[model samples]
Target: MTEEAEEELAEAIQLAQGLEVRGVNLANEGKLNGAMEEFRTALKGLEKFKRRTKLIRARIHYFIGNLHTLQGDLPKGLQEWQKAVRLDASLTDARMNVIKSLSDQGKHAEALRHAQLANSQPSPRVEILVMEGDECKALRNFTCAKLAYARALQANPRSFTAHFQLAVAHRDLMEDVPALHHFERAAEIDPTSSSVVNALAVVRGDTCQWGDPDFSENSPTNLLSVFATRDIHDKASPIHPLLLAYHLDNATLLRVVVDSQAREAARDAAVSVGHAAIQQHTNRPDPHARPRKMFSYKNTFSAFW
Candidate 1:
């Protein structure tokens, strides 16, 4: 090659390198738009240098794909990744990115195909299984979801998300007991998760007691007394203690306080029984020993309104 041609090629290579460096910096800073610009600039700079390094071309396409994916342009992103794969079929990052993007777009069948392709590559990662599980879940293919989740759990038993999602799939299939077990396992893995706690509470029954220490003055009758004062607004139906506390805390009874046919009678009965229950509990000396309070009024009145 002539000295001029060699020097021009070297300068083009340097410009491409500079563009890639700036693009990476932009991407790390969450500047997807700026990063995409830089990547395009790099590609343009390298276009004249057809004999440039294969590694450089692969990296450029991969980065551009990544930026496109981050920008929520999945089609464009996948196209770039496909290009990168063509250049370097062994690029696990590109393959995984394509699969993830496809999955995120709710293209489960396509994603599964891509996932299968990725798994066929050497030393596939556990994340591929997780991705397949997620796609299966989205597609409502519980059997497949369960299989994928099981594989993921086998690969890494400590995967809390996998356990949680498996529980969700089971729950969707009405496998409550198994769902409960997996949910509990997930909670054990991450105790502070409110989602797990709430799910457990709902599936087991909201009234189910969790620990010791009764807060009511009365003896154990049901989970209702654990949180509130139980009393009867009417001779027919008894109100729950927790429901009463909820109404009191909200400064509104279940019965309509105004503008209804049964308003006056309901309010009078609620106040009478609620006041009596409060007095009975207050007269007790051991406040901590008292069961949690409850509303004694039937929820029927609230349900009507």
Candidate 2:
């Protein structure tokens, strides 16, 4: 209550806050244990002045939760974030993490509940709306998903993700016109996005709009470049190999496939060189996950070859 006591409390809170900042720096530098210790020590100190330190304490817990996630302890991270939101109801980041994690774990109903709650708050985030859409989509509620994606686009007209997702939703419903429109918009917003480029091309193909200017100018170059290394980096595109049979001769296609396989193998080896031990421990083969092999069109191109 006295001036001296007030000054001491301020100094203590300042010190705790500094520790939180330091913890964040350490975490960014990949010193997870050191970051965790800093966060815990900061939180412990802040707990002493509970009434004045609630928000800062909540923030510390949020950082700690992030550290837990980086350390591959997702459930523990979720618990920490839950604590953070409880401590400070307006901590939207923590709430968003909780909702996203729940959604990823296929607890769509719970994630939707949290998302709705967050949406009801003032100035809800575009990401929350997108996540709500994703959850609804996962639950097979196409109407709800469309509405959420539309709302996200309404909030941020230039949002590439929202436009792309909305396009996919419309495309799935066999609505080609609107799908083409959104896909084109998405490609315009992020021209380098391979998914948008491929989808845009497919949608145009569906509508038989071969003369579309955007496709003629950029999409084909980007799409075809996926077969070859662009800037010495393998560009990722999931377009089917069969489609390329219509475009190239057998020898060219085989050469492309061979080069692609070799480049992919080299990249894998380079990436694993420093992380072999870590991969050995953590990369146990998933029973349900298969090693995807390159598709061969040997029969389709055999006569030409």
Candidate 3:
């Protein structure tokens, strides 16, 4: 813009900086209302340089938002944080507030929209991608969910949540090969997680590949009961009989899994016991649809658990 406009912006930055520093001092001295007033005054100047001074602009909004919350104005505080994120998508803290607000309101789609924006920005973050993946999975959009998790893993392969979610997404999509691979990786990284170990056991039983020593600690009662109590549903989703067999009794496993129809011999018995555990913990129950014919677990050994 013109030199006059540029000079105004520079002066505004100086004014906002002075207010921000003084506000922090007031806040520390137990003068919250005074600090909030200072913060509110700072916003007027920062608003003038919102485009060029993204970091400064966002910081002012964040400060104002914090002061508003300190004054017990949660809704107004959230509004200011929302504005901060809109100006600078890289502001993860501000984005988190917006996401949490949306989620608490049961606005899954809206949360996913902002989460996707956060992931698409520079230095794509793992946490936001996981949130996007979770939101997509909740909506039964497995394809997008897996893609989000995949991007997260691409950004950081050691992310246990990414591996777990990716495995679940692939399992939901009936893509057994990739599902099995990710599940194995997740189990390796977190052997202490019952969900991960239980899911691994189900997959091993399905493919008759029970060689891992890590899968040996789980009790048979815990593992078999999960699979034994459930049967093929009248719905369209596929729940491998092997996964249900672990929860059931001997007779139940014998009856529920075995059938006149031949079962999945395709080393792809991508199990979901592990997935179910995660879902239950996260309060996102699996939406099992399109039932597939499943046969009994032929390799149900006693020590396998």
Instruction: Give a tens-digit lDDT track for model 3, residues 1-305.
Output: 99999999889888888998898888878798888788778877676566777887787787777767667777887798888887777888778667766765678899899888887788878878888887887778999998899999999998878898898787777776677688778756764444564455455554444442222445443433433335444312333434433333334433333331124432223333334334433322133421343221111101100
lDDT of 2 by residue, 1-305 (tens): 78997887898788998998888888878898998999899888766678888898888888888888888998998898889888887888888888877876889999888877777788778877877787787788878888998989889999888887788778767898998798778867776665654565456556755442222445643444343324324456443222222233333433453354355564442222223222334322112212222211110100100
Question: What lDDT score belongs to each candidate, Candidate 1 first?
Answer: 0.60, 0.66, 0.64
Judge candidate 3 against the unseen true structure and give its global Cα lDDT, from 0 to 1.
0.64
Span of 10 residues, lowest total lDDT, candidate 3: 296-305
The global Cα lDDT (0 to 1) of model 2 is 0.66
lDDT against true structure, model 1: 0.60
**lDDT winner:** 2
Off by over 4 Å in 3: 1-8, 21-35, 47-54, 66-74, 174-177, 192-198, 201-208, 212-305
TM-score of model 1 relative to the true fold? Answer: 0.56
